[model samples]
Target: MTTPPHHPARRNLLRVAAAGAVSAAGLAAATPAWGRTTAAPASPPPGLSDPVQRGDLVVDVRDHGAVGDGVADDTAAIQAALDEGRGRTVYIPPGTYPVSTMLTVFGGTTVLATATTVIRRTDGPSIVGNGVLGDMTATGFDGESDIVIQGGVWDVNASNVALNGNGFSFSHGRNIRVYDVRVRDVQGWHAMELNAVETVRVVNCRFEGFSDPQGNRQYSEAVHMDYAGGPGHFTLFGAPDFYGCKDVEVSGCYAGPSADFPSYPRLVGSHGGPDGHQHTGLRVVSNYADQCTEWAVRLYDWLDGVVQGNQIVGGGGGIQIGPAGVQTGGNVVVSGNTLRGLAGVQEAAGRPPDAAICVGRLNNARTHRLTVADNVVEGVAMEGISVYRTDGCVVSGNVVEDCEGAGIRLHDAPRAVVTSNAVARTGGESIVVADASNAALVAQNRADDATAAGVRVTGTVAEVVVRGNVVRGDAAYGIAIGAGATGTWHTGNDLRGGYTTGPVDDQGSGSLTDPAGVA
Candidate 1:
């Protein structure tokens, strides 16, 4: 919940919006009040045995007294069909069914339908959830497996209402697949709340429409990867479980606003992890996120994840990796993403300070062994790539331009290698090695038309080497070293183009420079 003071984030930020009010962070946007008070079953009911006694592989909802009309309440009929269709496919024909109650998903549940089969919910909890509460044991997550919920449009029509209702909430399961499902208009909550689950794949789904709840819910995610750490957390009410997500993949998905609703505040991330636990094997790739309030993808306290090939536009930030709510976890690779116009999204939400790609929370959180490479960040208001408090990071082969702040900045990060980057038209310095960033290397970079210097090293930093970099256009200087900065070496740099000030302003202590090639 902490960030660099320059990058104003969604911990406790209050900003205006183009659609509605921008709420605060940590909204606690769980499901309805009934989900909070209902005593969840410890296990599946005894009657939920193999329902194929009638010698059928599929159960149709129309045969179970479900009128396909939009006025009839099809809650009981759908539940009856699903209850009888365990270990089978429960099919619903093309129609609009008004569901007013929560539907339970069994272990072997496979609910299939066409794209026209819509389950429009009223003011209620999640439309579908597993009917099991957690026991907080070591073997709690080994409960359910082999479930599939696919090929339908679930509209959680939360317009003009002040309730917290999600689209689908799954918990304590394994090998779950939720693909080809379109969840629409999820007001005040996440489209899918995955709690303590493992091996979940959310593919080719369209999560449309996510607005704030009645209270503060600005940081609400569309697909929330949550921990089942009991109540007062991201779980759907009283689930006395304790496990994080493992092997989750959210790819080829669309996370933006619906035609009738506003965009969600966030998408595809986690925030409620507090113990020494770590979510591992998370892969977020090839998603198109347009015009969100805060960020498109954010992972906190995560270990071994890859966020690549995502196209993000118009959010407060882009992909951010850090250690929040826990200590010592972030070994992530963020690469090949395209982030553009983040300033437009952040200013529309009334806070425009975060970078296109951010690593580590602040100067205090320490992330280890990160790789940020080959990303294209453009038209952002703040820094292009901002890394703070990380150890042994590599920022290479990136293309950054048209940023209001530095193209690439490292703060309190040690042993970082920044190489082979291309930067142009930056308002601040093109590359900055400052704020106690020791033992770093900035080499073979191409910088052009920076309003500030080409390369700047400030604060109490030591052993920073800026070598073999090509500085072009009229910057303030080729290399500017501030006071109190010790042991900086700028060698083999080509500063052929002129600047406002002279090239290599050496004002630091124990700084060495190569002979200038041009004045």
Candidate 2:
């Protein structure tokens, strides 16, 4: 193996050429006509001794003796190109390059391939395709920088390879961008695991075909926004230290079934660190997720996050948010999304069932200032949008229809405002404020054709103001208050065509006001 000359910085060649264009104009203007008609052979073009010439800025994998014939190894040759092509672009042409071992990617390198390029994994043990080679110690975020793996189809070949590993696994990197890539058939582990990094973006990618090889860990994500929280949190083969991810964006991706296998169980989410050591500025937006065994998006513990504008279908559940800092669930926003056909297949033991969007892990009152607004939900197996154990939250401006349970329910949530929403054709109540949800304001909502009451204030609650709602169509009771409720005020509700039984069935003795004559 002959080494090239010790020259670098091919990335600066474009700016250097632009600068030289101005300099050449100035020089030609100053020098009076030393010009022959042939222009003196172009002055040999700059960087005469550089290892990477301008014409060879894109180093092809074939140049390093890689026969991408699908039968040859091509591992050593492609790896040779990668090791020497650091700070440059290694272009893999359209072919199937199978490897029996793992390939390592260095920092400041770009592994670019055509749309027809498929890097398939041969039979191997613990092989992660095109991952980092070194610097994976216990210290977090100390590994690499300026890495880009874009535009290829990375096939894990899960049926042949039983040892569980990811398609692309890297840790402790910053300024990483993975764009326009597709990963298929990852077994047991995630398709892409980016752990403990800062400032990353995964855009316009597709994750297809994931299954658990050992029949365990059936709920792995396609794109896991993980952190270095000790042994299993990272993809490296050892114990990593405690660090978290911050300023991450995973947008415009698709996570679902492949051509042959099922979709990844958890599409895109994070099972984050402890309460105090939390991640920040995470966004899972504008993606399509389906057929997940767990929640499509789970914000376990993060700060200042946004799960917005996603289209989810046929998942176990929709977006779920838990604690981030101390007891606080972080200042998060869940809005402008469409969720349908959720069943909550793998919900935790004491949690509610099949809510399209759930705001808490349980009846947790420490998550404050959360917002769930402007979403659309239909064909849900249970509740449409539910929150529990929160404080000062707002559930507003949503359209929920054809739910098996309540459209919107608040459990053990205090100081919540459920306003300007619409619920229709529910199997149970349209809206429910129960489980000691105190200081709630349920106003200006439109409920229609529920099997149970339009609005029900049950359990042990206090200071729940139900005002100015329009409950239309027929139900068991228009607004039924359970006997265990207290301080429930109802005023200015229009229940003209509602309630097959009666208009307002107020059984609680601690009630304050009633609907204005049910006319």
**What are the per-residue Cα lDDT tens digits for candidate 2 across 380-465?**
88788988788889999999999998999998888899999999999899999987788799999999998889999998887788
Judged by lDDT against the true structure, how good is candidate 2?
0.76
lDDT of 1 by residue, 399-468 (tens): 9999998999999888999999999999899999988799899999999998899999988899788899
lDDT of each: 0.77, 0.76
| 229 Cα displacement, candidate 1 (Å) | 2.3
Per-residue lDDT, model 2, residue 409, is: 92
- CA deviation > 4 Å runs, candidate 1: 1-55, 132-139, 213-215, 235-238, 344-352, 514-519
Cα deviation of 283 in candidate 2 (Å)? 0.5
TM-score list, all predictions = 0.85, 0.85
Question: Candidate 1 clashing pairs?
Answer: none
The TM-score measured for candidate 1 stands at 0.85
